[model samples]
Structure formats: structure tokens, C-alpha cells
Target: MSTQPTTDVAPSPPAPSEGGRPSDGLQAGLKNRHLSMIAIGGVIGAGLFVGSGSGIAAAGPAILLSYALVGALVVCVMRMLGEMAAAYPSSGSFSAYADRALGRWAGFSIGWLYWFFWVVVLAVEATAGAKILEGWIPAVPQWGWALIVMLVLTATNLASVASYGEFEFWFAGIKVVAIAAFVVIGLLAVFGVLPGAHSDTAGVANLTAHGGFMPHGPGSVLTGILMVVFSFMGSEIVTLAAGESENPQRAVSKATNSVIWRIAVFYLGSIFIVVSLLPWNSPSIVDDGSYVAALNTIGIPHAGEVMNVIVLTAVLSCLNSGLYTASRMAFSLGERGDAPKAFARTSARGVPRAAILSSVLFGFIAVFFNYKWPDTVFAFLLNSSGAVALFVWLVIAFAQLRMRAMILRDDPSKLVVRMWLFPYLTWATIGMISFVLVYMLTDPDGRQQVILSLLAAAVVVGIALVRDRLRASRPATASAGGVRDSAEGEESLPTGS
Candidate 1:
């Protein structure tokens, strides 16, 4: 008789589990519906809306290659993450996995780096959304709109996990619908089938019309990669959200199975339509957005405003998810002794109140610095965070190497989502990410982002080394009286080294 695999995991921790503190103290309030939508929505970020414009202009039709390349890279990383997460579900996600596979220091550095990344993202998304609102309403100053937007989302997150899930579900839905409609309508325009679509300029010819598909040559496609890759940043949020889902394995598996195609269609497919509908050199593309310009070509009323509203929704979705993710990671870190115990505490609604508030507080402070010195303070923060997503992915790739072997040594059945080509593809992904980081160093702007991020990572790593030393000397004090090895419950050797 054939046997089917099963998955029922007990969470993993950086240190031993303590007596009273829960790994997350999070409720299973996130429904399957919410999980699916969050997965779908998280893939579509505001970066695609605003940043894709720059990608198209730079790489022209060849930008599709950039998107596809990065999309494939994301697929490999996410699949590896899904594998570990399914076996050992944790709110900390990759950071927790890094701790188990690498070391406490590795986990500590990445956890804090990731939390820092999202907190910074919260500020960026809030600022972007505020600018759009302030444009619409003359009464509110930009800072006022920023404050209002951040507070509203913060309240939604603080209310309950379900409230955050519901808000993200709707926010992602709008982006999904908007992109789907844009693809359908834009494709028709390309083929000269849709009414009001200018077929004369919109067709396959547009691909070669300006300077040909490889207009800026192969090099631009690589540079386009730097631009296109960051848009895929939020895709990892799915596995993080899975910890709170009713069925974590199922949720992570589903998200892993489908994220690739979703990104391919939304990012690559959408860009294809834009390039097809108009020349890459079109002046209007940059100012109005490639999508907005395409809509204008078809004579849609208030096309720019319509796209702006959609962008705003994408921004809000990002802000909502960013806050939730950062807090959850902080919650996990606290539970593992990598953060303060207070952060591990949760309210009745299963919300990490201290973690959430701290994350939001940093976000608010970032927004303030953004206004005071947009060029200096906020720019440094942005650059420092620029490469963290890649760094996290790199850690995931390496963690999966050890994780996969360990899972096999323990029980392979729990790996519901397997990374393709195992060691080879895993090595290849690691190499590819390293290459991107190095490639960025060649450009002045990209170099700043990379250097700043590395400096930030180095600082975190130094802190982690000190913390690990302190923990080793006084484990009891570190975990607040003591921590029990859950390996007794997990029926395995201790995950910690």
C-alpha cells in the first residue's frame, strides 16, 4: 500500500521555549479565505505600480526578461521558505529557520534586520499613500495625511489579527481586480480588438518600434533586474502569515504553489501590455505611469486619477501587511530571547501589543525624518533597507540546505512544498542573489543601497554575537528564569547548536 505524507508541526525556537510565554501568543483568527487573499494580495505591491515605470523606460520590452528572472528567483526562495515553514511554523519565518540551521547569531541578525526592513517600509508606504491623499484633499497637510493613514492602519492591526486580515484582503482585492482588468483591456488594445484602443501604435510593432527589444542592450536588462527585483519584496509575507492561519501547512503550500504564476502575470504580463500598447520612449509613460498611460491611450476617463486610487490601495495594503509582519517577527524574536520579553506578551485578541506599538512608533519617527530631510535621513534609511530582502532570501537559501537534509534525517513527510532541484537549484539561487548584490555595487545609486545595507547588517551581526555570548553565559537570565527544550515535545534533538 502507498503512504501519503502528513504535516502537523510543533514550532521551533531560537532558544529553548520558556514556561509561560507562547511562541507568538497569536490566535488562529486568520481564516483560510483571508490567507488565500493575503497571499494573492501580498504579491502585488505599490512598487510594481510606481517602479515598473522606470523599469519599462530603461529596459523597454526587455524588462519582461528582468521581471521573469526575478520572479523565478523569488519562486525558488519562497519554495525553500515554504518547506521549512511547513515543517516548523513560526511567526518569525525565515529568521527562525536561520537560527535553527545556521546559528543563534545568524537568526538574531536576520530577525532584527527583517523587522527593521518592514518598519522602514511602513514609513515609505504611509508617505506614498499620504501624498496621493493630500493631492486629492487640499485641506490636510501631507504630514497630517501621513499621520491619519498610519494611525488608521495601526488601529486596524492593534484591533485584532482578523481585522488586519480583513483590511489586507480588501486592499489586495482591489489591486488584483485592477491588474486583471488592465491586462484584459490592454491586451485587447494591443490586438486592436478593444473599442477606443489605438491599434495603429499598439501592437507587436511597439516591441521593436523605438530601439528594438534590446534597445539599451543586454546590460540594461540586468539593470532592469535591480529595478524589477525589489517589487517582489513582499511575496515572503505569505509564509509569515501562515503561522496565524488555521491550517499553516495548507496555507503555505497553497501560497507556494501559486505565487510564481501570480507574479508572472501581474508583473511580467502587465508590463507586456504596457510595452505593446505604446512605445517605451513615450514621454507620458513616466509622468502618468505605464498603466495609466495605457489607459489614457484607450480614452478612459480620469485614467490617471483611477490609477492613482489603485496605487493608493496598493500602498495601504503594503502598510497594513508591513505593520503586521514586523510585529509578528518581533513577537517571535521576543519569544526566542532575541528580543525583550515584553514584546512576547499579547492581548486577549491575540495581538502583540508591545511589538505592534514599537514597530508603529519607529514607523512614525521615520515619517517625521522623511519630511525633515527627505534627501539625507530618509534616504539613508531607504538605502540601508534596500538589500535586506535579498539578504533574507540568501539566508533562506542556505538555511534550506541544512533544513532539507535535517528534514530528511528526521521525517521527509512534513515537507509538503519541496524546492525544485534541491541542492543544485538552491546553490544556483544563492549564487544568483550574490550576483545581484555585486551587480548593484557597480552603479552609484545601487552601490549606496548595497553598502548601507551591508553596514546595517554588520551592525546587527555584531549585536547578535554579543547577545549569543551573553546568552551562553547566563541562559536562565536571558530567557527570564529559564527555558525548556521543546525537543522533548517535538521528539527530536534540540534545534539549537
Candidate 2:
């Protein structure tokens, strides 16, 4: 009953720009290479670099399993997303799927919620990256560095899609290389082969000797999952960016297919090296980053500062991709009439100028909130957006279930990508995501985040329902008006035709 993959057509038409031509809209400037690195770079983020420290402390060496658990979750979600993205690539891929499979309300609500999450991400990453930069150059205030970082990336996005691709290719490349080098160098040190390095702390013994691998008990592995799970959030950016790629289906298929190894090598691989090199309980692990701490323990000079540079690279890359993602989602919403029409318009260079600026505008406000209230307004916004990853995956699972049935029913020939194990695995992924949500409700902090996210999601859903109802009623209202409406309709008809 399974249908084989097929060549994909151009993605849905881009929203008309100010010039009234589609060419003025987004261009397929992203090459396959860019797509590959974007996916790789998206998965290996600040979470693995910085957040892993807390995760190790919470669960000790067994934090690896927590990552594996979450990585499996990401793998499942990405596969489902890729199936749809490859079949019919769109900038609004998931939301569009929700629209067709679930309903416009699903699409509109999920689309806006997803956008909300990334805009908040833009603020968080900017502030994080600013700290790294401010460490090196004490002359500039942290806020000034944050502003500078945001403005630079915003301009990169506005310049053109190719510019964004080039920047990310290099940015992600550095991250890829840095982690890879760390793995190789760390392994060499572990085996006591590296030059000018001590290896007393580097061995498999460290994993068990410190705290028998599960220092905080098995409950802490779940706690570690809570601490480290958000690190996997940005892996799906490839599909969104792939809509503007030369071969959207190929790019998507490759990225989705390779996700496992990418997660394995970059995440599991580096974490394994770090833990093998130093005991999980080392105080330096938290003070410096996990990788930096491991490197310093192995006698790598200035390793903490050096890893800070790579972390800075990762932070900027995340911020750049965040702006790109939020704007495209907005543009998709505009094209579907789910958002203000201005967001749909692109510039002469095929950049969605309005969308980028608008996304950044909110980002600036979030930054202000971060500065103004560490615990009040900003905290709520942060938590409200925090739980969106699981919610999004849940939507994708359902959407894919519906999407699989649709592909099988209506157009099996267009089924270029199919979810693994069909309805069974789809349901499993859904159940797993639900479990995480319910689990969140048990922790006070997690409960606050889940509750706020739900409230926000509900508001977005309400707006979507009302907006859709008004839109649905417009034609009936127009029809009820008689000859004036007929005259208006006639006037609206294409003149030349």
C-alpha cells in the first residue's frame, strides 16, 4: 500500500510583493549544501553547548539517555514533518498541513503559536550571544551588544535569502567543525595520545566512578529530560528554509533522513566525549560549559574561553535562523490571509522586508521586557512560549496521520515521503508528546509554562476561529446585498479578460 517518492513541483506561489510580481517574492537561492548545513547547525545549538552542563548535574553521566530520549522524540516529529514537507514543500509546511488536514483554525493557531515561540527565541539567543561577546570586549554594555547582534542578523535576513544561506553555511560549519574537533581531540586525550595533555581524568572509569552513571537516581534522568529537551527545538527549520531551495524535496529528504546520525554524532558523540573526559560531578562543569570544562580538565589551555567563542558562533547562528524562520512563517500566514497583508509583500531583492522587520519589532520588545522585568512580564512570555515544541510535535503527529490518510486516499502518486509504520508509529509519537505535556503539569515551574502556553494557544485559537467565521460569512453577506454586490463583483473582475 505504500507509494514511492516522486519529484516535487514548485512550492505554492509566493505572496505578491509591492511590484505585483511573484519574482519580487522569495527566490530559490538556497542550494542543497546550504540546506544540509542548516539542518545540521539547527540541531546542534546552545542547548548542547550550554544547557548540557545543568543536564549532567541533574542526571550525572546518564544524561546521555535523557538526550537520546528527546532526540528520539525529535526524530519522530521530523520524520512526520518531512513526509509532508517533501510531498508538498511550503514555507508554511506544517501549518498548511494543519489547515488542509485538521482545519483553518488548526493552521492559523499553530502557525501563530509557532511564530510566537521563535520570536521569543530570537530575544533569548540575542541576549545569550551578547554575553559571550561582552566577555571578550568589556567596552560595550551587554544591552548594546544584544542590540547590535539583533540588528546585524535582521539586516542579513533583509539583504537576500542567499546572503542568509551563505552566513548560515559558514556559521553552522564552524559549529560542526568545532564539535567534531573536540570529539577527536578529546578522544585522543582520553587515550593519552594528545601532545602536552594529562589524561588521568580521561577514561571510561569516570562515567561510573563518580556516581555510578546515575548520580541523582533514575528520576533525575526524567528531570534531565526536562532540563535538556528544549535543546532540540530548532531542527525543523530545514523544511521551512527548503521551500526556497532549488530542490526542496531532495533537500528535505536528505535532512530528515540524516537527522539520526546528526543527533547521534553531534549530540551523543560530544556528550560522550565530555563525560568520558571528566567526572559528571566536577564543579567546573557548571561554572564553565561542559565541553570547555572537559577541555580544561584535560589540560587544554584557555579552553573555557575558546569554547565560549564557539558558543558565541552558535548563538548568532541561532538568532540569524530564528529571524529567518519567524519572518517566513509570518509571510506564509500573510499569503494565506491569516495575517496582515503587509507581511506577504517582498522587496525587489526577493526579501520579505515587512515580515522580517515586524518579527524583529516584537523581538526588540521582548528584549526590553527581558531588561525591564527578569521575573514578571518577560518570565511569563518566556514560559508561555517554552512548551510550544511539544505542542507543535503533537500537531504534526495528528496532521501527519490525517495527511497520510489523505495521500493514500486522494493522491497517492504525490506521496514522495511517508511516515514510518503508518498509523501505529504516528499514534505512538502523539501519545509520547501528550505524556510530556501531562508530565509538565506536575512540576510547578513546568506547570506554569504549560499553563501559560495553553492560555496563549487558546487566545490564538479563539482569534483564528472568529476570523475564520467572519471570513466564511463574508460571501453570504455579500450575496445578500443584491445588485450593488453584483455591480461590485463585475467591477472586481479582471478588466482584460
Candidate 3:
């Protein structure tokens, strides 16, 4: 029996443009290889490099279980997202899907919130990358390095989508190679097979010999979830970037299918080597990062500097993608009449120049806030955007549930990608995400982030509701005129009446 809905609407809504909205000027400049590397490399984050230490400390070797849990959540979410994305590829990605499946309010709220999240990330990654670069060259100030890095990536985005893709390809490629090599070499040392290995403590027995796996207690596994969940933020970026590829559906399908292995190899595989190579409770794991400590255990030369280089690459890759993702979301919102129309316009090379500039403008302001008011204003920005990744996954799951029916009824052939277990897994993903958000309230930092993020979301949702109400009250002629002349650029509203 087919699980798909049988009821059909005659003459369904038109399919959205693929590989960029040609009607409004987003272009198909990304090649297959660009998308391939983005998907492969996107799974590994700078957080995995810098943030995993505390998780290991808290959960002991059971931190691996924490990572595994989050990885499974992301896998389920990606499968749902891929189902919709493969059916109707859009530059707007999940936001667009929300517009179609849920409502304009959903699309508008999530889109702007997503944009806000990445712009904040811009400041975080810029500061991180700048700190590294300044250490390498003491002559250049940290702020100057931040400015230089932002300007370089901004120009790359404004040049063309292809330029962004090419840069990301190499950046992601480096990360992929770095992690793969780390895993293989660390594994070699773990089993005492490496010829030059120095540390006698390197062995698989380290997983249990230190404190019996869950040293602190099983409760710490949930704590580790809070520590590691955000690292998976970039995993969905390839779905958004796919809209600019030569084959959006094909690109999305391929990326979605490969996600499991990518997470398994880059995240779980490397962390396995880390824990197996050294005890999770080792002071070195907490003092230095997990990866750096493991490398040092085996007497790898200058392990600190080597990890620094890799961390810097991850930061740069994140900053580069942050700009691209934020601008593209802005471009998408503009096209749907939710934002200023100038963001919808594109350059001759098919770059959304105004959108790029606007996103970077906010990012620059964020960078300023980071340096000028690190505690109050910058902390607010960071906390407010912290829980947005969870919000995004929730929205994607809901949208997929609604969108699956629409696609099946309208044109089942467009279902190139399908979610496993139909509505069952989809509901399970939603339940897990909700539990995570609620569980966050029990922790101090996580509680602050959730409260601030909710406040931010409420404000956006309020604005959207007011706009919807105002549009509803206006006469048809006036509504049309308002779309044309209003400063908000609410033209050609895509949300169905």
C-alpha cells in the first residue's frame, strides 16, 4: 500500500524555479563538485574542534553517546528537509518550504531569525579567526584581522555565487582531509601500530580504564548534548546552496543521501579515535582540546600549532558560508515581499549585491559589538541566536509533514527524495527537538539562551502577524497599491489567501 495521500487538487500551484530564481535573478553558478564538498565538509565544525573538550570532561567516554544522539537527530531532520527540498528546490530552502506548507508568517519569522543567527555567527567566527591570525602575525591587530577577513569573504560573495562555491570547496576540502588524516593517524597510534609513537597511555583500554566510561554519571550525557548540538548547525547549509547549483534536485538528493556517512566519519569516527587514544578524564583533554590532547599523547610534534591551523581553517570556512547563507536568505525573503525589495535585485553576474551588502553591514555591526561591549550587547546577541538551530529543525520537520502530502497529491513523481518511515520518524524528530529545547531550561547558560532566543522569535512573529492583519484589512485595490508603494516592499505576496 502506498503511504502517500490520494486526494488531489486540480491545477496545483506552480513549481518554484530551480537552481536560483531566474525570474528574480539568482543564478545556477555552483557546480556538482562544489555541492559535493560542501555536503562532505559541512558535518565537521569548529565546535567539534574547540568545544568537545568540556563535553568529554562532563560525560567521560560516554560523550561519544552524546554525539551519537545529536547525530541521529540531525540525520532525521535532514531526511525530512531533503524530502521537501528535493521535491521543490528553492534558494529560500526550509523558509520557502514553510511558506508553502505552513504560512507566510512561518516563512517570514523563520527566515529573518535564520538571517539573524548567521550574522551573529559572522562575528563569532570572525573574532575566532582573527585571534588565530593575530597570534601568527603579531604586527596586525586582532580587530584589523577581523576586518580584513570579513571584507575578503564579503567581496567573494558579492562577486558571484560561483566564487563563494569555489572558496567553500577548498575550505571544506581542507577540513575533510584534516579530519580523515587525524582519524587514521590517531587510530594507528591507539593500537600501538605507529612506529614513532611515544606515549604508553595510547590504547583502546583508555575508554574504560580511567573512570569507567560515564565517570560523572549518565545525567551528564544530557549535559553533553547541550554542549554539542549547536555544532551541527552547518549541516543544512548545502540544501540552501543547492538552489544555486546546476541541478538543484540532484544536488539536494545526493547531499541528503550522503549525510549519514559524513557525520559517521567526520564526527563520530574522529571522536572515537580521540577517546580511545586517551582517557576522557585526563587533565590534558580539558586543558587542551580533545583532539590536541590526543595528538600530544602520541608525541605528535607541535600538536598545539597544528590544531590551531586546522581550527583557523574551520573558522574561516564558517565565516565564508555564514555570509553566503545570510545573504541568500535575505534575497529569498525580498523576493517574497517580506523584506526590502532592493535585496531581491541581482548584479549582472547574478549576485544579490544589495542583499550581500546588507547582511555584511549587520555582521560588521555585530563585530563592533563583540569588541566594544563583549559582555552586555554582544552576549545578548550570542545567547539570543544560540537556540535558533533547534527552532530551524523544528520548523523543517513540520514543513516536511505538510509538504509531503502536497507533493504526493500534486505530483508524486517529484518525490525524488522520501523520508524514512513516513509520518512516524517525522513525528519522532519533532518530539526530540522539543525535548531538547525544554531540557535546555534546566541549565543556566542553556536557559538564558532559550529565553533570549524565544524573546527574539516572539518579536519577529509579532511583526509578521501585524503585517498580515494590515494586509487583510486593506481593500484589494489598496492592498495591490500598498505592495507597489509601501516602504516595506510587500509586493506580490506569495502566501496563499
> Which candidate number maximizes TM-score?
3
lDDT of each: 0.83, 0.81, 0.85
Per-residue error (Å), model 1, residue 23: 6.3
Ranking by TM-score: 3, 1, 2
Q: On residues 1-497, what C-alpha lDDT tens digit does candidate 2 reach at each position?
A: 01112321112233222211122146677888899899999898887898899888878989999889988989999999998887667777788678778887888899999999999998899889888888889899999999999998988898889999999999999999998999899888878888888768788888899869888888887887888778999998998898788777688889999999999999888999989998888898898878889888878888877888898999989999999999999987776667777776766566777889999999999998998896899898999998998888999999998777666665565567777888898898888888888888887878898999999999999998887777666754353323122111211101111
Sort the candidates on lDDT, descending order.
Answer: 3, 1, 2
Give the clash total for candidate 3.
0
Better of 1 and 2 by lDDT: 1
Q: What is the C-alpha RMSD of each candidate to the true structure, in Å?
A: 5.5, 6.8, 6.3
Question: lDDT score, residue 308, model 1?
Answer: 92
User: Candidate 1: misplaced stretches above 4 Å?
Assistant: 1-23, 475-497
lDDT of 3 by residue, 1-497 (tens): 01112221111111334332223456678999999999887888899999988988888889899999999999999998888877766778899888768887888999999999999999999999999999999899999999999999998998888999999999999899999999999989988899899988888898889878888888989999999999999899998888777787788889989999988988889989989988887888889899999998888899999999999989999999999999989988887778887777666677878889999999999999999999999999999999999999999999999888888876788788999998999999999999999999999999999999999999999998898788778665433323343223332222211
Which candidate would rank higher by TM-score, 1 or 3?
A: 3
What is the per-residue lDDT of model 1 for residues 1-497, given as tens digits with 9 covering 90 to 100? Answer: 01111321223343312221124456677888899999898889898988888888888899989999999999899899988887766788888788878987888799999999999998898989999999999799999999999999989999889999999989999999999999998888888899765547888798987888989999998999998888888889988888777777788889999987898789888999999888998988898888888888877789988999999999999999999999998887776667877787777667778899999999999999899988999999999999999999999999999998887776666667898988999999999999999999998889999999999999999998886676567634232224334211111222322
Q: What local lDDT does model 3 show for residue 452?
A: 98
The positional error of residue 222 in candidate 3, measured at the CA in angstroms, is 0.6
Question: How many collisions between residues are there in candidate 1?
Answer: 0
How much does candidate 1 score in TM-score?
Answer: 0.92
User: Candidate 3 at residue 379, lDDT?
Assistant: 100
Write down the worst ten-residue block by lDDT for model 1.
Answer: 1-10
